[model samples]
Target: MSPIRTIVLTLLALLAFAANSVLCRLALNAEQVNPADFTSIRLLSAAFILAIIIVIKDKSAIRHINQHGSYAGALFLFVYAAGFSYAYISLSTATGALILFAAVQFTMLFKGWLAGNKMGNQEYIGLLLSLLGFIYFVFPELEKPSIVGCLLMILAGIAWGMYSLNGAKSTKPLYDTASNFIRLTPIAIIGLIATYFYFGLHISYKGLLYTTASGALASGVGYTLWYQVLPKLKPSIAAVSQLSVPIWAALGGVLLVEEPIELHLAISAAIILGGILLVILAKNKH
Candidate 1:
């Protein structure tokens, strides 16, 4: 893909991530669906949509769904999903986001180091600038996270980090992501059973509407786009780039969710975006 196309797709994927948070909040806060059912339907809908997309892309893809993805990727995906759903129940968005973001970057950076990759001084500066900006952006809203909630969010971050690492190695991102989603079938079933026994199934058309959009657009397509970008990016770059997620999320929240925009958000955004640019452009010196 051309550089412009890659940038556009990356931005779109970020937007999808932001939209997901808004959508989930809308549905759950309205009591339209419980967390368990929401997680189940989100994965289920994404899987179905991705499967259709794959079939349309290539009729032969039917037999290829399980060809590209590994069990490890699927397990990581499940862990991320489960941890995210549960963590948000007890943790404030700022607190959860801070922990999750830090953990993801650290996990990916650690993995990159283990893989024999090295970062330049400029890259280190960029990473620190971006992280600091992200922390500042969310600082005012952050609350003390509960022990369990903090731990869950951290696990979610690690799971996502591993999933991204796996995707970075895929030759066929679309196929691999679709397969990962398809592989979630058993995990989704387990979630359904656990939720059924604990809270029962709560269904609503409105809730389904939100979940479906979240799955098909924000998740299925979004993740595929992200996977496509991963191969072109270093793990550190990819992780730092994700600091922009909350900036976009805050923007979307203001425009779509009617949340007020704060001055610090814009200030931090410049720092984060600038830091990302440096990270992307500065050559690795090691």
Candidate 2:
């Protein structure tokens, strides 16, 4: 692919991911679908679609699951997918994405520290700014943030960070991506079953459709695009690109669901995005 095509495709992939958040929020907040059910169906649908694609295009990808490093990937996937979906039942999409991404950033920072990478003053400042922004954004909704919900989002973010870092260490990115989903989908299915009995919620047609699109298009296809472009883009560029996700998701909420875009939300988003950019840019400079 040409340079322009790669960049365009990468942008499209990010858009798809942002749409995933929007779709999930729509299914839950508008359609009254259980978040757990939405998540499970999404994962299962994506797994099925990917299975078909792999079988047709690359049967060898399945063998990679038996390799030495596949388990960690699968574990991360299960934790992230389940927690992320469940959290959205109580949390706003914008708030959830901000918190989750914040956790991911911190995880990366700590990982760097553990690896003996020097942390600069600017990075510390950026972290503080971002954290303050996050607090501000979520403060209005704190009355009933649901302890379980917050914890689940945090855990999901950590799981995703671990998944990204681990995938970086793997020799076969495609195989790792595919195998992780295959392993993770069953766990997601189990959770859906448990949630049904525990919460006494039924799956609706709207939920199934939303989840399936999320799983197949966003999780499977979007991720494949991410893996393809990750090696090509600079880390700083990638980070900046992800900053667009929350903005896109917020806009999506406003447009699709008529969610209010409060002044504080805009302010908080500016702060978080500015801080994240500063940190990423500073790291790249060195």
Clashing pairs in 1: none
TM-score of model number 1: 0.80
The Cα RMSD of model 1 versus the native structure comes to 3.7
Worst 10 residues of 1 by lDDT: 90-99
Off by over 4 Å in 1: 92-95, 116-147, 234-236, 257-286
- Candidate 1 lDDT: 0.75
lDDT of 1 by residue, 38-156 (tens): 78888998888888988888889778677888889888988887787677666544345545665676677667668887778887897789778867755664565456776787899
Clashing pairs in 2: none
Residue-level lDDT of model 2, residues 1-286, one tens digit each, is 5789879978987888678878888888778887777777777877777778878887876665555337777788778877888888887777677667766766776787799988689988887898888788667667875556777888988987787677555555555566667877667779777987899767677777777888898887787677667667766676677778877888888788677777887898888777877788789999
Which model scores highest in lDDT?
2
State residue 211's C-alpha deviation in candidate 2, in Å.
0.8
